[model samples]
Target: ILIGNLFTGNESMGNGGAIVVKSNSKPKIINNTIVNNHSLYGAGIWMSCSALNVVLQNNILWGNKASESGNQLYLRSTGSTYSIINNLLEGGVDSILFETPYSGILQDNYMFSPEFADYATGDLHLTCSSLAINAGSVPVVNMPLYDMDSNLRLNGSEYDLGAFEADAAATIVSQPQNMIVMNGDIATFTVVANGANVYQWEVSTDMASNWAAIVDDTIYSGATTSLLTVNSYAPMNGSLYRCIISGNCPQVTTISLPALLLVSNPDGFDENPIAVSVYPIPAYDFVNIIHAAGSRVIISDINGRIVADYAALSSDNEQISVSNLNNGVYFMKITSSNSTQIIRMIKD
Candidate 1:
């Protein structure tokens, strides 16, 4: 029985990085963190046993690499009796080898990053932002009293999905920043928070007065995850977006600040004869503009307020520092002797 263990950085030339169950063993692997292991097959675990009553539950298998396939797990026995439940697998079904007409119970598995606190130094502790917090199977019989870190196994009503349990409090790591995109372009907003929580992104068209829950449709995607993407159009301009994150075990909830979306140049910009380039969209600190010398440049916010202006450009490459600007949308207009070009900018 392998329980409350950490299996990491192991390598194998043939089968498994951590464990290679043969044709006869019945192993119970529960509540473990198996990560960063590599092998030719099944970088985390490889089980080919035809034995009965093999159990695997409440474990995390992530960030493992395999040369052939099954980077997390490989199941070679098609008729083995097994039980797999409530594990965080990185690649979902694709993480396992093929076994048709399987004889096992697989339930409540997740296919996302477990979000370890410090993966580089091999500290696999659960961070406040880990989805593994309070994500395990409920009513687990004969479970361990404490996790691998010696913390209480059940920090909340339910056990966490990994070998470590996080604290109950939920905190936002980074709020979703505003986006600026051209008409027909895609705009995305992402939020980073600490905890295993439910996420629901909402939109407010009436300037943060009334909000409506967004759904997966032709207009938007990932309304339920921390990241949201929108198929932007002119009508989505000035729309406010926010995410509602909630967690259990005291029921902590957080509502993020509403960020505005700006769609620039709904009618599209006129083409200029001379080639002008503005690069690194969704810029964080600095944005570069390259064009002909002696071109005049002007930058304005969504409200048509001039933020930065240059009377005449002396060089081909001009760097504009957007470090002080608030996260949102802006427009840049560059004019040469004969032609003028306007481009949309997003301060991410």
Candidate 2:
């Protein structure tokens, strides 16, 4: 009996290059691939002397060469009981089997080349579109639990014909990259992953420490696909974005690395540019803001943390106290009725 055996690249001067059955010996060959053998009679299998009750199920007997009849099988036995079910053959049972008054069951046998992953390199794994996938019948006895590669035997509807099961794992080809865009402009992020169908993009405000799923809105689009678009805003600075991918293989999910979003405030963004000025480069007591009146001012440290905020500058050249702040570089964002401007500030 042969179960899950690979027979290839063998030669013989006589009969049976790979296997031989004689003297009424009944053999059960299940889930074996017999190919690429050369012999004078049967290159794959030679049976004689009334071998009865032979069972050949879920096997592949193809690509064999012989000098005489039966390139795949030479059966010289007569009145032998045999069952050849769900076996993929090279010639569809008429080109190989040479028996007088054949008495056996030949059901669900296919005549086509089983598309191997690589035939020259001896990689017998089935490809994605192989005809042997899900083509075997249900085994009533002596069914192996796993294939030759240790993959589950029945990954799909039924058993596969050959040795190895197909691998269907998803592979992440590309990841999203960081983007820098001006405020009020649009930014795009894209990812590429093979064998993946589901994509969910998320955003994090605190450098990926926390995440929230992004949806279709005024600021974001294509959040559920490989590409994600965002409308750049001042508040979105230092935000992080990533994508969660899944749905190619069973119970397999993955997430991409976080990408930073840096939003810059461009000059003359508004139609009417406003004159802005700030005094005291390294201020000790107070910094004067000489800009349009009734403007909002925001001060942040180098780490993008808001340190101080002031609104509704009632007078031109308003004085902002900087005595309580630490001695370091800071950023000041001033917004007026017409335009906005960002300036660098220093405290000593």
Q: Which regions of candidate 1 are displaced past 4 Å?
A: 99-101, 139-141, 167-348
Q: Write the per-residue lDDT of candidate 2 for residues 1-348, one digit (tens) a residue.
A: 778889999999999988988887878888888888999988988887576678888888878888877898888765577787998888888756666656778788898889988888877777777888778887647667777777666666567786665554345789898787877999999989877778889997753447899999999999999999999987887677888786433334567766667677544356446668898988788988886589998887655678888878989879889999999866677878766666667899
TM-score attained by model 2: 0.50
Best by TM-score: 2
Tens-digit per-residue lDDT, 241-294, candidate 1:
888887653343567767778776544333325678888899899988887579
Cα displacement (Å) at residue 310, model 2: 71
| Model 1 error, position 305 (Å) | 64
Q: What TM-score would each prediction reach against the true structure? A: 0.48, 0.50
Report the number of clashing residue pairs per model: 4, 0
